[model samples]
Structures are given as C-alpha cells and as structure tokens.
Target: MLLKSIRYSLDELIYLLNQLSDKGYSKSCESLGNETIGEHTRHIIEMFQCLENSYDLGILNYGNRERNDQIETEIEFAKQCVVEIRTGLKSENKILYLEHVIGGLAIRIQSSYYRELLYNLENCIHHQTLIKVAVLKFQNIAVIENSGIADSTSEYRN
Candidate 1:
C-alpha cells in the first residue's frame, strides 16, 4: 500500500515536472512569476527528501523551511529527487516513527510512517496548489486547470 501510494505521488510529480519543463522559465509575466517553475518543483521534492532522510536517520528536522536557492528546470532536480525517494523506500523499514510537533495541541509527538506519508502528501499538495495560484495570479496564466488531490496533473500549459 505504501509503495503504491508513493508511486502514485511520484507519477503525479512527474507529470508536474514535465509541464514545468515544457513551460520552461518565464521571464516577466507568463512563466512562473518571480519564482521559476524549477524553484517550486525543487521545493516540493526537497520536502519529501527531507522526510525520507529523517526516516532513515530516525531524527526528524523541525520547522517548515526551504534551504535551496531557485533552480532551473534544465537540471531536472525534481525527477532526481523522486528517483532517490524510490530507492529509499525499497528498504525493509516498514514502520517509521516520525517525530513532529503538533501545532494546534502544542505538543511533540511520534507519528507512524502511514501518518507521515499522508500528512506529507497533504502538505505538499497544498504548497503545490499555492505555487500554481501564485503563477496564475502573477502571470495571468492558468498553468493548471484545477488544484485537487484527485487531479494528478501539474503545471498544464494553457
């Protein structure tokens, strides 16, 4: 189940990456706003990579912060990250206790791999949609027709 879920996400991410690559980088008002498509792509993959690293080391990194600079799609960084994620998941570790802080309850907690993956998917999708909206708002281009978990495509050029 975990593999299937992650693979589904990987496929969605690949579609998004392809769209971003097709669009290339916008200069002023129709590409990707001030943040290039690569930037958004890298951010999403980086988030997942971090989670995978934390799971491997059994030490979760707190705070939702992005560290890398803006990237260009020529590097295909997002795809590389997805490949790494796939490799990591092949391990035998089925149960991962992800340590995270509960914001609303104001408590630290240890969550299972299933919860972690689900939450990560939700959070990443929200951020991805936000990036899509930002592009639409700044460039006046609807890169994506809709923003929903059910819609797997990303960065549709239209």
Candidate 2:
C-alpha cells in the first residue's frame, strides 16, 4: 500500500512534466525568486532518491542529497529518475534510523522504510504545488489535475 502511494505521487509529477515544453520546464518565476519549475521537480526527485539510497545503510540523512543539475534541466532524465525510484520502492520495507541535526546537535531516531516513503510522497506533493503555480505564471499551460492536493483533501470535495 505504501509503495503504491509513492508510485502514484511520482506518476503525478511525471504526468505534469510530460505536459510541459522545454520552455515551461526551464522558465524562471519572479514570484519564486526566479526559481524554475525544473528546480522544484529536481528537488522532489532527489529527496526520494536520497531516501532510497540510504534505505539499507541503517541511517537516513535527507540533508545529504545530490542536487543534480542534469535532472533539473533534462525533463527526460527526471522521468527516468522517477522510474528508478518507483522500481526501488518495490522492495520489502524494513526498520531504519533517521539522522537529523538540531541546533548543532545530531540526533538519530528509529523509523521504517515505509514511513520514509510516506514522507517522500507528501514532500513531492508540496513541491508539485509550487511547480504548478510557477508553470501557470510562466505560461498559459494547464496544470495537472489535483497535482499537489492530498488525497484526503480531494475526498471531501466529492
């Protein structure tokens, strides 16, 4: 169930990316300090990749992400990365630890792979919201239907 949810979130992003042209993907928005939609998409993909890479290491540190520029500017590359992440999530979930730093102090807490997947899904949705807004402002492109809204929020509309 968790993996399915993660895949759905990733698919939502891919669908949105597919609808954009190179200009829409790379265009910077003044409202967001000139940050492009590609940047936001890259950030979302990297967060999921970071968690996947650390799944077996017993310690997950989200701060240590590779912000690959290629993934940001290359729409096809970002789609491939999302596919890789979705494939990686097919494995069985396991207990893991999350490492965080608070006020110069490092803290490690117990967590599970499934929980981290949920976190990534939610994070992607939040980033998608920003991307959707930027895309709309940069061009008259139609945003993805329910791209960033949580499922629970949409359920109430019905």
Which candidate leads the pack in TM-score? 2
Which 10 consecutive residues of model 1 have the lowest summed lDDT? 21-30
List clash counts for every candidate, in order. 0, 0
lDDT of each: 0.57, 0.84
Question: Which residue pairs show backbone clashes in model 2?
Answer: none
- TM-scores of all models? 0.60, 0.90
Candidate 2 C-alpha error for residue 22, in Å: 3.0
The global Cα lDDT (0 to 1) of model 1 is: 0.57
lDDT of 2: 0.84
Cα error, residue 26 of model 2, in Å, equals 2.2
Segments of candidate 2 deviating more than 4 angstroms: 138-140
Error of 1 at 124 (Å): 2.6
